[model samples]
Every structure is written in C-alpha cells, then in structure tokens.
Target chain A: MTSFGNEPLFLGIDGGGSKCRAVLYRKDSGIIGEGLAGPANPVQGLERAQDAVLACASAALSDAGLSQSQLGHLIVGAGLAGVNAPRTRAAMLSWQHPFAQFYLTTDLHIASLGAHDGTDGAVIITGTGSSGFSQCAGQQRFLGGHGFPLGDKAGGAWLGLAAVQAALLALDNLGPATSLSQAVLAKTHSQDSTALMDQFCGQPSAPYGQLAALVFDEAAKGDAVAKAIVADGAGYLSNMVLQLTELGPIKVAFIGGLGGIWQPWLSDAAKARITPALQGPEVGAVIYAQQRYTGEHAP
Target chain B: MTSFGNEPLFLGIDGGGSKCRAVLYRKDSGIIGEGLAGPANPVQGLERAQDAVLACASAALSDAGLSQSQLGHLIVGAGLAGVNAPRTRAAMLSWQHPFAQFYLTTDLHIASLGAHDGTDGAVIITGTGSSGFSQCAGQQRFLGGHGFPLGDKAGGAWLGLAAVQAALLALDNLGPATSLSQAVLAKTHSQDSTALMDQFCGQPSAPYGQLAALVFDEAAKGDAVAKAIVADGAGYLSNMVLQLTELGPIKVAFIGGLGGIWQPWLSDAAKARITPALQGPEVGAVIYAQQRYTGEHAP
Candidate 1:
C-alpha cells in the first residue's frame, strides 16, 4: 500500500462532460484505491470540477493511507469534459498539482487507452453524452459529439430525447404508436398525455436527458419503439467509430455508460459494430495507470 | 384530359413492411378514386410478391369513362425484393379491375410519397435489403438509400440469424469474440477477424442486411474489431429521423424491407421517432397522387 513498496503507485483519472472517475494502482498494475464523486463540469467551468477532483482525490488518498508529499511520483490521466476549448485546455494544462507529473486529455483518449490496453484502438462512448474516439500509432482522434444540437447523437441523452418525442407523438396523434407513450406517462405519474407534453416541452434539455433509461427499460421488455431507440443509438455510435477509424487501422472497443449497458438490449448488429476489447473502460483506467507511469519514467 | 384521350399517366407507389400506398390523382380529388395494389415484389423475388395484392385502381380510373375489362388491375405498392414467402397474404385478397396499374413501390414509402413534396423524412428499408428513407415533413422525403450491410438493421433475414450469440466481445486473440461476431463474419464479406475458416459462410445470407454497411465500410475504415456495427446502424438511422423532426413536425413514417430498422437507429435524444397510423398501408400511393392533384391529402 506504500508508494515505495517495491514499486511506485500511480493515479489514473478519467474526467469528462458528465462524471469523473479515478483509480489508484500499483506500478505493477494492481488496484489499491478507487473513488467516485459528483459530476465535474470541466468545460462549462473549472471551479466545480476542481472541487470534485479534490474531493475524489482526497477520498482515494485516505483509502490508500498515503500523504500527497510522501508519493514518489504521480501520473494523472484525465479525459476531461469540455477541454476542447482553448481556455479550458489551457486551464487544464495550467493546473499545478502537488504530484510530480500529470496529463490531462479528452475523456475519449483515456477511455480508449483503458479499453485497448494501450494499443491502437477505438472506443465508442455513449452516456449523458456520446462520442467515438480512436488512437492508432500513439495518436488520438474522434467523431460526433459536436453538441446536443449538432452532435451527442447516440448517448443516454439521445435515448431520453427519443422517448420524450415518442411520448409526445402518442399525445399528438401525429407519431408512430408505441407503448413508450404509457411508460413516459408513468414517468411523470401523469394521468393523461397532456401532462406528458408539459414534462418534455416544460423542462430544459439537460433534465430531459435523464429519461433515456426509461427507453432502455422499455426496449428491454420488447417495446418496438424503445428498441428502435437503442438500435438507432447503436447505429450512430458504431458509425462514429467506423468514421474515426477511417484514419488508420483499428481494433475497436466499446467504453462508456452505454457501452456496457447494452447487454440486455443489444441487437445482433450492434454487437458487430466495434471489436470488443478484452477489458472494459475501468480496466482501461488501470492500463492507463500503468502506461502513464511507464511513459513518465521509461528507462 | 378525358379517359378517351388515350394517354398514360404517371403513378406514385409506396410499399413498406407494414402496408402499400398507391396514389393516382389527375390534378383533382373530385374524381380521385383510389385502388389497392397487392404487395409488389419486383425486387425481392423479382416481378412478384407471394402475399402482395397488385391492385391498381386510381381515383382517375373512376373518372375515366373507359372501364376496359380486357386488362386486369396493375398493382404497384408491394415491397418485393423477394419478400418472405410472397403471395401468402396476396392470395387471400380479391383483385377486380378493368385496367392495368403501373407499380411504383421501392421500399422507400415515405420518401417517394413525402420526399418529392419537399418533406424530408428518412426511411430504413429492411425486407430482403434496406435503404434510408427521408421525408422532410411538408418539405421533402429524400432517400439516402438502402445500401447493404450499412444502411439496414434488426429485420429481414440478416439480423434474425446474424448474431444469435457470442456478440458481446469479438475476441480475435481471445477465441471468437461472440456468436454475434461469428454470425456477422460468416454472413458478411469477411468471416471474423483472422480470416474465415469456412469458404461458404455467407451462403444463407444472400442480400446482406444494412448493418453490413457498418461492417464493410468499417473494414474499409479499419474497424476490423468492430462489434458495434448493428448498434451504429440503429442509432444513426434514429438520428437521421431526429434531424428530420428537427426540421419540423413530421409525418415520420416507417414502412420498408424490415419492420425493425428505425428502432435500432433512432436511439438519439435529438431524434423524433414516430409510430405510424394503422390505416390502409398502401394508402400513401393513393395519397401520393391525391396530394399532387390536390394540395391536401398528403402528409
């Protein structure tokens, strides 16, 4: 459990649009500490995200029983939410940490690193936000996730939005008939369809994304509409990976909230969209821990 | 123009998995008499569908003074592509007519009907093959087309049997990722990552599903480990509809090669997945011509 326990201990963090995940691992690649915390808004603002990271890091430190100053060196890998902006990117680079070294990157990069075991591969992430990223020959790239208006096509948010639309169609009599109508109505506990409209048109977008799981549940039970939602998501997501890989060779992988969530509702084609890496994103995180540690001090 | 004028008229037909639409109106609905066409299977089984009722009764026919009995009705709204066990349902229907009806169904029901009018609604056909149907509600229904192994999902012959199991992980070095992988590779151009052991893997699956587009293109794109192909198809198609609805309130329709194409693709939050009406299937064919004759009568 000590940093000097025959080998160094490294920290790998995956921070992105929605949530941030961090795991403490041995240089030899064993998990020692793991911590999960609130959503760290990296793009929108950094103050909140910094606080989240501090809280998560503190928790991990406590779990590992090591003081920050006692660590020999630390490798921090973060795939942040909105680091796409210059200001955000600069802010990430400017953050001076107590650790010896840290690397901040887009969430997709870390996710891919974790999934591919650090080789050239791609990862399609579907969650509150959705995107696909590929890293080949030690370089990174991506597709989709421009924004809710422009991208984020096949994320959980997308699923939720489809559910809302289906619910509304059932309400207006202008859409395909689906059981998703009843389920949506039940979500609000609304006695009528009119009330359902208020829920969707009534609220802003971020809140609406919360309803995606409802569609997933409905699809799990064989609702054609709901299944369509997931299927469509699979199509969009897989296409992104395909497009990203257009750059070079790819051994693809799925790594995200929606990546592993498709077990119950995955269709035959979705399973064929990307090459499943032997390890999930979490495992990717551990691999990242080892890679970053080695990369920093490769003899 | 009088019926005795002896001039052939242009006809619009929409054939889908659910229903067929035939619209024949000569610039007016007052004389618009609609005729039913049994399913037209010129594509699937070539020139005839088993269950298809190829009835061709145009609203113009009722207006035509010549009720010629020498020729039977010409049906156009059957989704042929060698549809499953054709004539199973067509044999049950009665076809009584004195004129020939030109067939016009291409599995792109809404687009052919709605696209020409400027309404852009996308359709994914999945009978024997699949296509993307787009109709911009009240604007145009432009079709992206149903390209094999790329554009379709979840229906027809390909999906039902492609990945029965072992789809979750396409373990190349790990021994056949999943049954889904084996199924896809066997049915696809490439039989899994390492090269197919069987030379005749694609025997049963002749006209590959649109999911193949993801695979074939992904392979071209270097997603050799791709297992998310199906999910991508479904998600992207759904997003296409989302984009359609984003344009405006739509007559989002789904009638094509497969009953489950849009479901898998429409998983995006931005998508507007519509459940269509149960009214006459080929009613669009009549409506197509009707809308042309009268501004009203088209979705």
Candidate 2:
C-alpha cells in the first residue's frame, strides 16, 4: 500500500445533476480515498460543475494524505451528466485542471464501462430517466434516453405521472379506484381531481418523477393500476433490450435507482440475460481512465 | 337585418389561447356579423385576454352596423379556454363590461353544449389536449382532458412526442426507419439522433404538438411508424369513449383542430355512436346565455 515507489495514482469522477463523487486509486493499493460534492452537471452551470469537480478531487487527494503538488502523479477521468451537450462538454474540457492528464465522457458511457468491465455489453438505465447504452467491439450505441413527459416511458417520472393520471381518472369515475391513485392524490395534497389537476399542471416533471417509487411500492402490493404501469415500464425496457440484442448477443446489465424494481416485471428472456454490474459508475470512470489513457489491463 | 325594432342582440365569444372569435346575432336576423382578434386566454395574460375579448366584440359590433353604445342592448356569452381555472374565471367574471348580461363557461363545456345541442350526449376534444365531457340527465361527467406531457395520451403533443421517439429509435437502428422519422429529422434540422435529441429536448410541448398533424398525414400515406402512433392514439381515444359510455348509451361528437383526424381510426362501435355537432361552440355560448339568462328554450 506504500506510494513511496512513485506509483501512478488514478482518479475517477462521476458528476451527475444532484452530486459529484470521485475515487482515487492505485493498481496495487486499490481505492485510497473517495470524495463527494454537489452537482457537477455542466449543462446546469459550468462554473458550478467545475467548482464541484475541483472540490471533490482536492478532497479525495486530501483523504489520501496527498497535496496539490501530488496532482502531477494523478491521471483523471470524469464521466459527467451533460457531456453529451457539445458546448458544455467542450467548455468543461477547456477548463484548467490540476491533474496530470484528464479524459472526459458521458456518465452513461462510464456506467456501461463499469457494468461490463470495459468490454462489449449493454446497460439499461431506468431511474429518473430511461436510456440504454451499449459498447460492442469499440462501437457504441445509445437508446431511449429521452427526458420525462416526452420519452423515458418506464422511468421514474413516467411511472409517477401514470400514477397521477390513474388517480385523477379514478376520481372522475372513468377508471377503477386503486391504492396507487389514492396515494398519489394524498401525496399531491389534493382532495379531488380538479384540485389535483390545478396543482399538478403547474409543477415541473421532477416532483411527479419523485413519486415513481411510490407507484412501484403500491404495485408490489398488488394494486391493479400500479401493476399495469409497472408492466408497461417493463415492456418498454424489454423492447429496448430486444432491440439492442439485434446488434449482437451481448450481455446486458440494469442500472440506476429504479433498476431493482423493474427486475421482477422484466421478461424471462431479459431476466436470464440481465447481469449485475461489476461496480458503480465511478469505478467505471476509473476503469475508463485506465483503459483510454494508462493502457493498463483491466483490474 | 335592421336594428330599427330595437330587438335585443346576442354576442357569442370563443376566446382561446391563440385567438378570439365573436359572432353577433339578432333573434330575427340570425348571425349578422363575425369578428376575429388575438388570443385572449386569461391564464396567459388577463389584460391581453380582456383586450382581445373587447376588441373582437367591438369589431363584431362594427360589422353588424352597430355602435359601442349599443352594447347596452347586447347580452354576451363567453366560452373561454381557461374558464375552468377558478382565478381566471373569477377575474373575467368580475371585469366591467357593457353587455346587458354575461355568462361564462369553459370552452369544453361550450363545445359539449354545441355538440349535444345542450342535450344528454358527449363530446371528445382532441387537439393539444384530450378530454371527454358528457352531460347525462343533468349529471356532468368529465374524463381525460389532462394537459400535455402528463395526461393527453392521444392528443397532438403526445402523438408528436411518440413520433420523435420512434424517429430517434429508428435512427439508432433499434426500430424500422420510416418516412415519419425522416420528415421529423428534416423538420427539426437535425442530421442524426444525437442532434435531434439535443434539439428536440430543448423545445416545449406546443411545437411538438404542432407536429402531430404531420404524423397523421404520414399515417394517411401508410408509413409504418406513423400508423402505429395513430393506432395507439385511436386506442386511447376509444378507451376514453368506452369509459364515458359506461354511464349511459349516448351519441358522442369529436371537436378541436385534430378532431376529425381521429374519426377514420375510431372503432366501429364508436363510429356508429359518433355524430356531428349541429353548431359551433360560439352558438353553444349564445345558447348557454339564452338558457341561463333568458327563458328561451334550447334551439
């Protein structure tokens, strides 16, 4: 575990909309330290994202009992949330950094890397948003990452919205009453459908998306409406997987906050094919750095 | 068409988000004049809406060869877009106007009134939003009508969004490439899925909803993806109508800009039950005023 041999250090940063996390590691010593900070999604705010990145990296170095002078020995990889936005990604890449070398890519790409140990595989993300990413023989393909209310059919936001719609319909006597609807009605603090519509129509997609977990929980208890939503979500995911498999017979992984909830509802074929990730996206970011820069064999 | 008899005049106004229309009528002369003005949706701007309403009314008066002072002889009925919003309705009702009497109701309510001739029937409004409203033996039952992105499943915005999603998937080689996708890509000025997503995700629901007509047009041309989207939209509409009919067997009328677009795709049962509106929402407004303010029988 000694670093006196001038061993090279690696840093991986996973910067999402809500928070940023960094991992510092070495081949022999393994993970030496980790740091976390607020959102570092450059599309939201480049300055804020940069600040989070610097703070997390510095904190990680401090936890590893290192100083700014030691930055020269570290190579960094950042898998960021908004790296798909060209302007944001370009701006982020041009910023001055303390690391010896830096590689930047999307959070989805790194998640795929970590899930398959930097090999050819696919990962379906079904948290607040829904998307699929796959890498096969160095060629990458993306699917279904559209944001809430438009796409992300099986994502948290979509589930929550469906729950609210079901509740409203039940209240209107257009659909059967279910616990999921009742729960959503209560959660939105509306006594009736009209009140809920007035309130819900004014809010953004995030709050409804936050209610997706509640929908899943209610479905697990056998609420018919909830089950229907879950089934629909699972069907969308299955379609994504089926579409991805057409490229090649690649192993697939499920990732994101809502990942586990979708498993029970997935098709038997998808169930047999889906595999757990080897590690988190941060480790994937580190692995990406190692592969793209260090030329070191996967650990 | 002479006003020499000093017969009372009626003005029916349909004020929506994009435009305001008014028709001036006399008991003996029928509709004497019509006028159009800018949007008067109070939810968007109370002042602007008030202006549009007033301007349209004034223009109608002028077209009818009447003067502003003649407003004292006129009764007004306004079927407005945001009359369902309590604040907007209340504010509009409280405004000072020259009309001898004023009746305010939702555009949907007026549309229903016009479709059913103020009888026991139903109307499904499918444009930017989708909703079913029925009056059965004086008991009003409202279904769907959830605004864009959350509820309006079969509406324009929903169709456009589904089209975009299909286009992106097709571009990704996850689905069959179709004319709908190519047109959408060209319309959005996007070279590929990445650019399309980057562009599409930034726009609001209105623009997407506007694209819905294109989907219907493509569906008419036998595009596979477009046909699928149309089928799905029709299915949602059918479900809405079927749910509405559970209360009672009644004729249903479809209204809105995209209203007629759905007719060919409706189920045979729905087609059998569907009927045309005898008049427009403005006439419905006028009829509403006559029914509520005067002792006139529905005509």
Candidate 3:
C-alpha cells in the first residue's frame, strides 16, 4: 500500500472557465495551503489547464514541502471545464496527468458541495458560464449552462453578451440609448464601434465579464435596461433552483459574480423559495478534503 | 417565365415542437392556407414530419388548384426538429423533395424569419422548448435552447418545470402555501399530491406545459406565484432579445404558446428595448421563396 506524504496534505480544486484554484488540508484535517492560477478549462483546450493545474498544484505542493509521490489518496475533486459532456470529459480524462486517484466533476457540482458544507443542498454557479446542481440521498441532478453560443443564459457570459448587444444596438440607433456605450468606451478607451470591435476581436485579453457588472450596477441605479437584466437573471436563477429542488428537500446557495450582486435583494426571496443551509465553494472544498482524505476522526 | 396561381391561394406553415401549422396563402402574395399538427420534431425519433409536410402541402396545393410544374416555384422552408445545429444541418439539407427548390433551417431561424420577413430580427420561440436566433447582413447567430434537459432558461419548459417544483415544494411544506396545490388538484381531479404524482408519473402525457400556463393565467388574475412567473417570463424574453440583437440592428418577434400569452403585456416593454416586428414563418418562407426561386427582391 502507498504511504502518506511528509505530513501528507489532501487537496481539492475548483477549476473554472476563468480560473483554477487548489486548497490543501492537513493530515489531521486542518487547512494548510492554497494556490490560484489562470483558467484550467480541460475540455475546450487542455494544454493550458493541464500545464496550469500541474504547475498550480506543484506550487501548492511545493509550498507544503511535499512531492507528488509523497501523498496518499489525493482525492482531488476538480470542477472541470466540460464534465457534463462526454467529449469534454473524455478529453479531460485523457489529460496527461500523473495524479493519484484524481476525481473530476463540474465546478458547479463542487460549488454545490462547498455551498452546503458537503450536505444535501443545491448551488447555482454563475461565472462566464452558469449551472445549477443538487444532491440529496446521494443522487445529483443538473440544470442549464450547457455551453457557449447555445445555453448558459443568465450568467456572467449571458450578462456580458447582453452588454455587447446593448452597445451594438445603441450604435445602430436600434434601442433606447443607455450608458452601456460609455461604460464600454471607458473600459476599452475606444471612440466608436470600430475601436470596441478591435478590443473584442484583437484582445490583450479583454475582460468580457467586466461589462456584466456595469449592467448590474447600472440596473441597481435604475436603468430600465439594467433592471430588466437583474429581473431576468433572478428569474433564471429561480428557475434553476426550482428544477434542482425537484429531487427532494435541500438548501440552496449562490456562487459567482452575479450571485454576489443579487444576494442582498434576493436573500428574502430565496428564503421563501429555497431552504436555508448555505456556504461557499472554498470552505466546502476544505470540508470535503477532510472527510475524504484525512480519516473522519483523525485529529 | 413562370405563371402565378389564379386563385391567389398561398399557404403559410410554422412547424416545430408543441405546435405545427399549414396556413395557405390566398391573398396576392399573402397567407391563406391553414392546418395545425402535432410536434414535428425533425431531430426526434422518426420521419413523421416529412409525411406531414407532404400531406399538408398537398392539401394546401389542392385547395389552390396549383399543379406541380405550372407553379412558379413552390418554395418550401422548414425549421424542423434536427435543424438547429451544425451536425443536423447536413441531415436537414439532404431532405429535399420536388418543390422547384426547398429551403431547410432551424425552427428557431425560420420562426425569426417568419416573424419579420427574414430581416435582421430575433425570435424567442417558446413552444415545447425555447431557443433564440438572429440573422443580419446575411449571417445567422443563435442563442439558448440546447435541448430539453438543458432547456433554455425562462422558457415554457422552464416555466412548466418550475410550476412542478413549486407544487412539490408546497407538498413538503418547504415553500409558501399556494393555489398550485388546488391547481394541481383541478388538473388531475385529485385531492392531494399523491393523485397528482400518479398523473405526473403516468405515461408522460400530462402536458406539463398546461400547468405552467395556469401559473401565468392566475398571475394575470393577481395570484402571487403566478404573477411572479409572468414577470419572470417577460424578464427572460427581454434578456433573450438583448442577446439576439448582438449581431446588429434587430427587430425581435415572439412566437410559441407561452410567447402568445405573454406577448401583449411584454410588448410595450419589449418594444422599448427591441423594435418588435410582426410577421411569422409563413410570410418569411414566401419572402425567402421569392428570392430563391425567382429574381433578387431583397429579404
């Protein structure tokens, strides 16, 4: 049998479209190390994520003074890029990794686990993408956020995409004039649609999601356009929660940028519609690592 | 070089999930034919739609007294079950029959075209499913509606799916006490959740969308839960419109069962953001047919 590492650290990761993170737990079940890096989207294109995951993991591992062979039962529960899809899954599964006993899944699933402290609950994850997942009696179900150009309505990408449309509409004098143009202009320092196009097209890596926040902020300040988006996003989320809870009793949690913005206004609404138990993915990862790696009673 | 049908009989057909139609065009260059059928999901299990199309077209043709060869050009455009995607595109393209020339596209694309004569416009088709499409400057773009389990957020299926959840939530006392219980009771003619469950689980022909409509109608009459759903649906449509207009100046049009119900209330607000264009697929097909079979008249 394999032995534990030098003081052996268990690991968990929340690998997302924009970022990937790793959190280390102690042999005795306490938090030890943490590291963050750029996107590890193992499905779309795995090279970057593979390199990044390995490098990030090593950075965290190096910080903990442990080598790959030193660990026992790594139990890396990753929220991978395309876990719901077999092609993505197959690609990710084929990722050239040397991990020992690695467990991979969607980021939303891990967020669900993290949000409910590894218990029965549902989580709506909205980043560049959006997804809803629930677990009860060890059964899991997912709703929405299929992929880009098709699904993932009411997420950061959805909001960002809306902002782009609003900008285009205003440029063409198609819709009611709004400040989105100014916000995008300021964001890109561009004079007209041509410059804006360059930023989206040419790219020093423009943050497409940056505009989603502007829309939310503008909506909060009473722009009808923005208000429509918030109202729509809440509905998208509510719809997701409704589907997730179809299985059985459970709490609900929100994760991602839009969640952070809508949380206060939505808290009461959520209480009426969902159960109360909730938390975050980072904390959830810690708890998961403890239960799966360090013995439950290990001190 | 081609002769027109003397009776001025024209037919317009909109086929997809939840509703399918064969409306004859009778007025000079306008719609006159009319027939409705079941789900003609081309991506679904079989060849029923091809037969349905031929039968319905024949019926319309008979009504008009237009022989096959004498007809100017029987331009047939279809947005069927399997046409929304790239993989299905080849299959859809290959389904040509004798019609001078036939055009096949996604129900989403054709619906958008039908709504506004295939101009730069968008359509939120919310029948048994929901999807959005926008075409501008001779290019097509799509958003939402990946599939059923991955249903577009804020759609008929989403609404139908949400109503079921609310009813279930009330069953376990996990949510507010609402009339959904009574609504469920009224639909299945059962007193409690058990009877409803029997229908819900029975043979899968319960028309779950019917329950979603009850939620919308009650909301119109001031039911709290129902009102939320109506506003929620309106909000989602707004977001979809925004995304569709991303390509360029787009006049959005709504279609499908839930779209019809919600269109009136949503019109002013929707028009505020999108230039709401009125027309449907039948009109679009005629317009597309004119361009394809005869000379360039601009679509």
Reference-based lDDT, each prediction = 0.52, 0.82, 0.62
Compose the digit string of candidate 1's lDDT tens values, residues A73-110.
55555667667546778986787666655666676776
Q: Specify the CAPRI tier of model 3.
A: incorrect
Best of the candidates, TM-score = 2
- Lowest lDDT 10-mer window, candidate 3 chain A? A197-206
Task: Score residue B48 of candidate 1 by CA lDDT.
Answer: 43
- Candidate 3 chain B — worst ten consecutive residues by lDDT sum? B197-206
What tens digits encode model 3's per-residue C-alpha lDDT throughout B1-299? 23474433334455665456665554455554455666666655336666666666766665555554533345565556556545556755676565555666666666676677656677777765566778889888666554432234456655665665556545534345677656756765766444444455312222565676777767767767766766766766676677677778767777766666767656364656444446667566555554454453244
* Candidate whose DockQ is highest: 2
- The C-alpha TM-scores of every prediction are 0.47, 0.85, 0.48
> Ten-residue segment with the worst summed lDDT in candidate 2 chain A?
A1-10
Per model, how much of the real contact set is kept? 0.00, 0.38, 0.00
Q: Candidate 2 on B186-284: residue-level lDDT in tens?
A: 788889867877766756668888788889989999999899889978877876777666668777899987889899998887788788987898888
User: Candidate 1 overall Cα lDDT vs. reference?
Assistant: 0.52
**Local accuracy of candidate 3 as per-residue lDDT tens digits, A180-289:** 66676776687765455445531211256666788787887788777777787776677567667777877677777666675654535464655433655655665565
